[model samples]
Target chain A: MNGYAGKILRVNLTTGTFTKEPTPADVARDFIGGRGFGIYFLLKEVPKGADPLGPENKLIISSGPISGMMIPGGGKCDWTTKAPLTGGYAGASMGGHFTAEMRYAGLDSIILEGISPKPVYLFIDNDRIELRDASGLWGKATFEVEKQFKEKLGEEYQIATIGPGGENMVSYACINHDYGRQAGRGGVGAVMGSKKVKAIVLHGTKSIPVADMQAYRKAGMALYKACKDAEGLKEWIRYGTTTVVDWCNQVGALPTRNFSAGSFEGAEGIYGKTMREKIVITDKGCFGCPSPCGKYSRSKKYNSYVEGPEYETIGLMGSNLGIDDIEVVAQANLLCDDLGIDTISAGNSIGWAMECYQKGIFTKKDTDGLDLKFGNVEAIFTLIGKIARKEGFGVLLGEGVKRASKKIGQGTEKFAIHVKGMEQSAYATHNATAMLLAYMTCDVGAHHNRSWAITYDLQVGRDLVVPEKVARVIWLQNFRPMFDVIGGCRLQWVELSIDRDLYVPALEAITGIHRSWEDLEKVGDRIWNMTRMFWARENDGFGREWDLPPARFYEDAPTTGATKGQITKLEDVNRLLDMYYEQRGWDSNGLPTLETIENLGLEAVVA
Target chain B: MTASIRLSDSLKNLLGSEGLFTIEAGHSVREAIVSLGINPDLVAVVSVGDEMQSKDYLIQEGDTVRLLAVIGGG
Candidate 1:
């Protein structure tokens, strides 16, 4: 295997034993790597109906063939497991130097199995791997843990650690790496915590083997050149993801006031330009990235240094909570990062709580003497810590908005703003039918990473429920996630608008396999179907009903903002799902038909 | 009649200017972009002041149009 390290490392915590096996060739050929490998193993190995936070649930962390290579934005890896959040399929893409280090260790995937009797961290320095005593590291914040490890083990080592959120097994806890980057969705970190593993430190010096060195070098150089030549490169590096704040606000897609509105009047205070001028100190890049999207900032007012209050955080924590101060958002971002909780989920959960407070569903008695009002900056800070530590009111929030709303009642579930228990990331899809459909059908709940079609919605008609909109969403879902499968970032092609074909030759040279976009999309389709089946198998009666967005999207129109008086009709939502199911070759109930499964060659795999 | 078009940094780089330019009113955003020798497809968002508009939106006199490059969002 030219592009691969050609090994899989399995560590059993209960037995305190580890083993390495050869990476299977057929699996690589069919599934590629990264997310592809993660799902393949999840379905093949993990038994059905296993408790997500129990011993049976395994965490599959994998890097793709292009990882650690000379390819631009090649630092991405995939973490797949049975989700404690959604209780369905959980796969998150993390970008940093961890995947590169994993490749240098001559490993593709590190599978953590069973539960450790005590807290431990997996330590790997080349071939010398051990389950080190992490009793001292347990319950520590992610930054402190990483700092301690880096100080003790030296700077070359890359460490991924969980904070109190994970230690407490918060449903939306995340694994933090490289200070700020995270495998930041679902409950992969909770599963790690459930297994009592606090962190994984890695350092490797091995050179990755490629199929054709000459061709590989040429393709790699061409990629770098294209990225450099891209018109958007400098601007993308400058603003990172924050550039979209104004655009999202303009388009009525910025999540505001717990998604009650699409735009915030205070949006100007947190726009990309404001972030750049006010807080951004450095433009940070992941491993081998040309156009780095990480905006590292230092908030003088808060006296905090954090990687991002990126667009998602700004939308979810800033506008969505009715707090527009970028500095406050940055502090909140730092708090979430240190606590090892997903900011999107934490902010969303807080937003729901605030909305609940505004509706008089709860009083100061419920909030424990704290004003749980929207834009209550002090309360926002307090709740983040409580959520991580699972203290007081935080206990209810730690369970996530979906579960919390279900428990709270009082018509709160209607405005919980989630799809399948995962909080909707930052996009307010009030009238954007395509983007809304994308959120509804995304494999990992309401995450936008799978398919971001809001621009397409603006390009076409935002409120149109035509088949073209549905088709666009489907095409994007299949095409965009190939980057995660290939173990690289899609921003170069996505943000820079570089020719995606540049990757074809690069992949061919590295993998020694000829795959066109069509071929790769076919594989993506297979993986997509496999994940859909995984969801169906894990949950009872999983179908179209489970895919529905919160009632607020169709029922409540924003009283203010750009999307005021605009709403997606409930019938249009169904129509979009109908077209989506038909195009995907699924039944009306949204289950993969037997013929569709056979067509994708997943008969034995699904069975 | 004239309207001002404010290009983002990326668009400014593409067009090689100070980023602020003048365009004739009554022309569609797509046509204005094409007139400036830039591909209409390259611009992902077009806004006039705080309002997002499609490329087909007719430019109005004294309107300050903002154009942003395609952002395959995170």
Candidate 2:
């Protein structure tokens, strides 16, 4: 197939053997690639009720047709597994040159299966694949591991490694690459750790085959041109995702103090402008990117170099934890990246712990004599390392907010601020119905990458629980994740507001498959239903109740901030879900109806 | 009396140049957008200084209004 490396690499850690299989044409046509392929394989191969961190669970790393191509923001890959955190579908997109490198190595997907007797790293130098002993690198941090690999082999070898968090099997441990970019959710790294694999290093020089070389070049150039010509190009490059910090705060969507409030009073200290002025050293980009959003920074206060306290990190670790110093947030970001824990889940977990302490549910004795207060910078830093190592109180925090709150059990679950078992991302959806619904129904739990509709909430009405809001959420859920499927960054289209249609020609030229936004969305809808079914298949009684947001959003209206005195009614929450299910052609219980399953051609797959 | 309006690049593209201009005080953000021959739906957020305001917010003299077209968010 044009634009495909045309192979699936399977590595069995138990036997320390590897095999290469021809990429199945039907799967490629049906599932596309990246996340699409990941979910398809997850359901097809992984058995029912397989332990997420056990050998039965397989980690699928995949790239799409456009990956490694000349198209803008094409350097992305999907790391999918049954989440140790949520025990549901886990698909986290990682940016940088890894996907491009994977494609060059003649692979569409790399599936890691079974547990090894010893620590090892998969080395692939264009088909010279082997499991190299990684005993020395076993307990090292991500940056050190990658740096050692690069220094030993060469800079061309792209490496994805886990730190102590993954080694300890932290529930939200992430796979780190390019120093900072991560497959940053759902314990994908924990799954890898369970398999005794520390890293996957690759260097490939092969050029991808395209259907029409001349047409592909032209289309690729045109796509790049549109990105370059975007009006928001300069601003997007300048501030990256941090550009939304001020905006999120202004609109009262900034998650503050474990989401007890929306906006933060000390927001100015962590604003995008403040971060840029105080710490940002350079703007980093992934492969084939036009407007790089990675703000690499050097925190003088902590003497640390990290790739962002991006908007999510800033909101979660900065405002949500009540620490507004950009340097502090940057340092915390460095710790999470190196320690291999997800900043979102870790921050949310810490926030919950702080709230528990403040509310007198937890004494200093429970917190290891450390003052578990919001804005305790030293405490925050100490907790991050402990979480990664699962030491003392870190053991509880490493379980993530959902599990930690449940274990603690003193009304802390009400402020756990998560949907399903995954911690909610940055957006404080107290009154934003569309965004709240987006978090609730997101396939991988409360992740915002699936559907970012808070802006849409402001566009219409933040408090409106109408069908239009539901429709917008549904549409975004279907469309936005297609970038993950296609193995490219959606931020180009998202931040720059570039015409999405510009990629149609580029895709057609590369894959020789003509598809409009409508056709792509149909595939997205199919993937969505499949993932939903995966969740249901994995967990008993997965339905409407599983889609409910945390109680903090509905029960407690912030006494401060822009959303002060405003709260979504519990009745309205049900109404929104009811409308959403009706719009999505699902049953009242939120399962895909037989008719809807048949409509998406997933009856056989679902059965 | 006038209020300063700072247009994002998206608004500039829609309105065809003029990234910064002065609008009459007392006009709502929606009214200012409409007066500038732009659709109100295209502008997702309007802020006065550091605070976001609804489009119906009355522009005050000396206010520095920033308009943004946030199609999606993180």
Best by DockQ: 2
The 10 consecutive residues of candidate 2 chain B with the worst lDDT sum are B8-17
- Can you give the DockQ of every candidate in the order shown? 0.23, 0.28
Q: What digit string (tens of lDDT, one per residue) describes model 2 on residues A220-273?
A: 898888888775576677778887777677678999999988889999899887
CAPRI grade of model 2: acceptable
The docking quality of candidate 1, as DockQ, is 0.23
Least lDDT summed over 10 consecutive residues: which range in candidate 1 chain A? A230-239
* Model 2, position A224: C-alpha lDDT score: 87
Chain A only TM-scores, each candidate in turn: 0.99, 0.99
* Model 2 lDDT per residue over B41-61, tens place: 556556675555667899999
Per-residue CA lDDT of model 1 for B37-62, tens digit only, reads 77564575576765556678999999
Candidate 1 chain A vs. true chain A: TM-score? 0.99
TM-score of each: 0.93, 0.94
Cand 2, B chain, TM: 0.85
Residue A550 lDDT in candidate 2: 97
Please report, as a residue range, the 10-residue window in candidate 2 chain A with the lowest summed lDDT. Answer: A229-238
